[model samples]
Target chain A: MQPYPITAMALCNGMGDSTAAVLAALRAGRSGLGPCPAEFELDAVVGAVPGPLPPLPGSLERVRDTRQTRIAAVALAELQAPLARACARWGADRVGVVLGTSTGGIEASEGAYAHAHAHGGALPSHYDVERSHALDAVLHLARVFGGGLAGPAYVVSTACSSSAKVFASAQRLLAAGLCDAVLVGGVDSLCRLTVRGFAGLEVLSSAPCRPFSRERAGINIGEGAALLLVERTGEGPARLLGVGESSDAYHMTSPHPEGLGARLAMERALQLAGLVAADVDHVNAHGTGTRQNDSMESQAIRAVFAGAPAPAVVATKGYTGHMLGAAGATEVAFVVDAIAGGYLPASVGADPLDEALGVDVVTARREQRTRAALSNSFAFGGSNCSVLVGGPA
Target chain B: MSAPGFSVRGLGFWAPGYPDLAAWQARPDACPEDQSATPKAELLPPMMRRRTSLLTRMAAEVAAQALRAGGLDPTGATLVYGSVYGEIRTTLDLLAALLVAGEPLSPTKFHNSVHNTAAGYVSIATGSRAGNAALSAGRSTLAMGLLECAALVAAGEGDVVLVIAEEPLPEPLAAGRRWGPFAAAFALAAPASSDMPATTCRLEQGPNDKSLAPARPAPAWLADNPCAAALALVDALAAGAPARVALEPHLAAGWHCGLGAGA
Candidate 1:
């Protein structure tokens, strides 16, 4: 798999609403997590984009207006000019959009359902699940927005690994010649369904997350979006070098204790990149902060690197909270910044790293020249995807 | 833009009346009005079985049948699941619990609410370490799923199982849905090693060749089912005849599928 150039990208998380702001936050070693919103009864930390996201451009109201879409709109707005230029350079049909999402406006249903329950199961006349809860709503929004891209479009919804896997899918489409350029993204917004769901799972931490720490408690869920435009053309920050994926076949909600699936995903990613374990310069760990997840991920990293001074590992979830489906693509943005900008963001909240885990989880930001980095995203259902991004060929 | 095609190794279909290929072929267009009986996911052990939702159960049933029918190792193939309204019943259940006062959300239901739940259960049941994906393209689900399956096989991801399903929406949420409950699975492999005669499938750019997608075998004008588009191709596979199948439910997606000898 030859490297594909990432031409343009846009993303917003609790850390910041733009990539520049996010990078600035990373460079400053700031955390975006805060006390959970009062509206939600859950007692936990969260990473929510600041209030009042721009609404969908008017005409799309009937079929694609959603809080998730509004979150996506922020990213889409940032790329409008470049995206439109790509559409012009390559015919609209020659561009494709593939998004990854877990909570697709399910909040739309939450509000509607609340109204329905109060009114004896009668949903408001204005409610439209097809438009709002369409799990692929963000895909449609991307397709229609930014001057209308009419191409092969779809969505991947494999929990946290969803967006990371998009690189591979987009690569396939490009290699198979379905589209010349592809807009790959991940979109998910704060919703009671996700917050309450994590609470129900008993994996919600009342305090900020501490990845790979001895006192690690659980996850602080977040909402965010990341969009990257890839082309056969050059002149971008990084290249998507390789992608690898695997299933744990172990449990529904738990990862394999040995992290065999996670290890396979990393090794396979290296194999696809025409490199070995030694070629990896940095690692952006999933590091969900849950006891089981952090412990198992460390084991997997230790297994792969297998030497003193493994790759510099930073768990960004400590900063962004577990953004669910959007974590993968958003992390790739950080990896790209690490490679091109020559910096490694610290694993915020992981001050006293868990030495027993045996993987060096970096706790301080540093200026370092990184050539290639592997971003790991593992999800419930034991789904794992590892993506490698390189500085230049 | 026509894709390099693959071979169909086996097929699986399930619905209220038609539970298997044999049943489907017996009455190729039998969309039974009485939607009563459900798919029994026998491959899942009781413990795993008890935790699954109807949508997951339906997906497991068809995926197992296809893998077994193809004479391929059930755990050996990569999986691609395409569904618009995935794990809907589980989502509804979670929402109901969350909306109720004083009732805590169910952990099991929350775990089951992920769109990839079905793909995960199937892979876990078969003990497969291969990668699996759950995706959707709205009305173009089956077509997009086929594209993914073809790409995985082409990329040497291994043999592939492409499953398209959508469970019937219950009550208040029904208005947003246009499809009925059904599931379909197609087991696929890379083309022959040499120039040997075999059934093939190629997705091309054009208006669909509607001649191949026969009217679905349903009692009345039933709503479209996610799996409904594959009926014609399944029949052609059963009879070893050449046919061009329309993978998209609607005709205007600008993609065409050919399935049969040299198709």
Candidate 2:
């Protein structure tokens, strides 16, 4: 199996004003979630970063929507230095950009729609296809990094697993010799539409989410962005060991009762890596804290590991909430950090493991060396993806 | 990169105004107002038909047609549904419900609003207990779906794979008169015999300087070209030789697909 190299750094917003904040959050096992004000009509808990998110520069604001574009812009800014250095080292024209996002600029469009209905005018001339759809984030980021000159720019919006699939796409592109370096990540922000949409699904938990716990409820919606720089070079920060993607083709909203798709995805990833289940040091489960999802994933883990000692399991939704399409990429950043730091952060709200679940849940932070970790991202419509990441061999 | 091409075992389509390829090619008069045809309802069951968006109904109908055309059952067939803007009308409705009624949105509508909703609905309707995938690539929706279909077949996951591409009516705000609504489908399987025609499609870096050796314009450029380009390929294969069809470049990459008769 060919290995895809991770040649640069990963960045997020809540990791402490900077990359150090992310390190601090990991070391202290702190969650970035906080209460969202009533203005957003959101009563459930949110994993929102504290502080004012300044609007995008007027130049960029002229062409795009606000809410998500701001988050995408900030995420790009956070990784600018590392990305620029990587580009300089690998040639700017060799790098491509791919982003995973569900709600590209919908929040802004919703506002524009309301304005058009009330004022009876055009939808702010800037609401073009490049600005309103999911691809806008990718295009905007490409322009920011001068990668439009390099290769194609794409955005994947396969629900929650959107970003995780970007890693798979990047790997395939590299394997196909499409590009030498790629920017793969996901970004999503709090929007009334997403919040209300999930709320309508009756899966939003008012209290903090408890993943893998018998008493756990539903998930808390969060908003953030994460980006990883990838290249084909052998030497780098980490390597993408393998990626597995599958669609359950089961129910639209519900997972398979036996977690067939989840099991297939994990097994495929393991097979692609030529590693057994025991080789996986830790698993970042797609434990959304929802009743069906948590149980389904647990069943899949047990089916894969069987009688062997299950890998240490950690759920980051307690910290970052569920970022939907962005959840996969954001969680992968945590997995990369776990390998770099040699420890598994506790699942913040997970207390007692559900007796029905057959795997060990890491409730409290533990220090242990991990060579590799598997990150899982499951979406609505039964889209499932698992990515395996490991340290330098 | 030299993976063997899949066999084109069968083909099908469901489109506005036209229920089958014959009816579609007849070029019936367009609707006076929106020029959109009333979707054919007879293709799906009543229970599975309720509240389905134009995209879902079109995708399922086309997918089923492909399976039937191939003389294969929908059961256990791997599905790959590709679309650019998925169920836009339903998405608009959800947003409207949030703003006006402040009413809790319907879970059904919310689920269908996702890009992969059509793939899931097809699975449920066909009772397909196998792999399902939904992908989106501007202009390359069909190509992407075909790529995955070929890969899955190559990986030995299925005997045949169904690749379906459908685009919902462009809302006034979204499409701005750019492209119209259409759905196309093809059933691909591992080559059964060496004599069958073979085709290889790939996404390549753009601006090829090579002179056009009888290059065909993208399907979108062909006037009144709905469901015809797919049929054209079928015709081209029957009159076997080598032919290349250039799809509109997506993501700034030049993409040209080659189809040829093979031994």
Candidate 3:
């Protein structure tokens, strides 16, 4: 596949509400995990977007309000200029919007259910499920960007790998000549459903997550948004070289013990990019710190880079927790920054590396220029996507 | 604009009155008073079947049927699952446990709540490690999914199993959105080598002209769920004739689909 240039990116995750803040926090190896909000009875910590959020613009007032859309609005706000520029270059109709979200406004459903359970009556007026459908972000973003109403606008939802797969879908749309530019990324905000869901799975860590570390317990559910404007235009700061996806068909929750799907995704991504493990200088692993995920991902990474100089492995989940559907795009932002900034953000929570894992999990920041980097995002249901982004060679 | 299309090697469907492609084709005008009982998906191993939701079951059932009908290896094709809303019942179940019962969610139910649950189960059932994508574009989900399927085959990525499924949303949540429970699957291959003579599909980009539409009238459920649009395409494929569906108003550009005699 021909590489597509990424002209602009905007991200607002738990690590920071702005790109500059996120990059600084990454450089400083800071952990954003904090005590779970008092409202939730969970004992675990979480990575939440701090402070109040901005209200939706008057133009988007018609759209419903949910933590998910509000967070997406914040992220899209950062890309207003870039998005407008892209729409100008390629008429608004030529620009498509592809978003990923596992729980789109589930919190709204929770609130509606809570109200009905208490009052025992008709649901509230604003409690329309269709409005908060998982594809709402696509609609909201499209409306904000002016015109994707009748274009190739859709939502890719495959749990955690949702957003990463959006890149592949966007690339296909471009290769097939469906669109000239794509606003692609993901958004998932904190919701009781996701929080309690992870807790029920018993994978919610009581403290900050420790990815690829010996003492790692599980994950801290988090939320935010990451949006990138990709175009078939000239070379930019970063480019999406390739995207590969696979399914383990192994388990609904647990991944394949040998990480067969993960390995296949990485190999496929490398094959698509016309590169190999040797060409990769850094790896942003999908390390959620769960025993099964870390163990299997380590094995997969070792297999993909075997007999070659393996790239420095960095897991940013320690800094931002596991953002679920949004993690793919949010983490890719860091990979783009790593390629441009010429530094590897340390896997902050990984202190004593799990020697048994046999993978070089970076625990300290490294200042080195890298041309190619791979980002891994493996989701429940054995869905896996690996995206390669790097500086122009 | 429309690009060259793929051939419909095989087709599987589950609707109110139709249990399979042949059954549906047998009576194109039939519409059951109520949705049929969800299939048990005996094809799935007992363990896998136990873990699947009704939505996942419908998806797997149709996918397997398509592969079997086409004489294609399930392991060799990529799976593209499309839906407007995913696992709404499971989501409501988890929410009920949390908000109404004030109890922890059942781990099994929680795991099944993701949108890609069907895709995951489909891969596991087929023992396929091939790439799979789950997409939703609201009312145009089926149109967008077909576009994706056509692109994969055109790019020589691999044969594809395109499945579009949408079950009705639960009550209260279902009050405003009135979607019918339906599932449709297609075994698609690059038109250059498909064996289905009467069901080859060619895609080309064109104007968003409402003047060109499927000859068959859309079912009543088309208003509720977007994937019902497949019924029109299925009608043409079943009749073994030529048809063009204007995919505009749903897709970026208008898509002209031609069902023709195979070479």
Best of the candidates, DockQ: 1
Over B96-147, each residue of candidate 2 has an lDDT whose tens digit, in order, gives: 6776756888888888888777766766666665546566655545544555
lDDT of 1 at A194: 84
The predicted structure with the larger DockQ, 1 or 3, is 1
Q: How close is candidate 2 to the true structure, as a TM-score?
A: 0.87
State the lDDT of candidate 2 residue by residue for A1-393, as single tens digits.
467777655545443435567668866888877788455766778876555665666655324646676667666776777666667776766676767887677777677666556665466665664456544444555456443334445566778898898887677666655557778888777777778788888889989888988889998888777788888884665789888877776777889888988998888888878988888888999999988998999999889888566799999888888988789988888888788778899998888778788778899999987887889998887788999998876
Error of 2 at B47 (Å): 1.6
Give the per-residue lDDT of model 3 (tens digit) for A54-129: 7665465436767778888877777878777777778776788888888877877787877776776467877667
lDDT of 3 by residue, B1-263 (tens): 55556788888887666678887777656557766467666668888788777788888888888888777888888989998778888887887788644577788899898889888877877788998988887767777788888878866787888888888878666666666677888889887574444267876656656545535666565545756677777776667766676543454455566678521
Itemize residue pairs with steric clashes in candidate 2: A15-A21, A15-A22, A16-A21
lDDT of candidate 1 vs native? 0.82
Q: Candidate 2 iRMS, in Å?
A: 3.3
How far off is residue B162 in model 3, in Å?
0.9
Best by TM-score: 1
lDDT over C-alpha atoms for residue B114 of model 1: 91
Tens digit of per-residue lDDT, candidate 1, span A158-253 = 989999998889888877777788999798888888888787788888899999888889999988899999987768989998898999999988
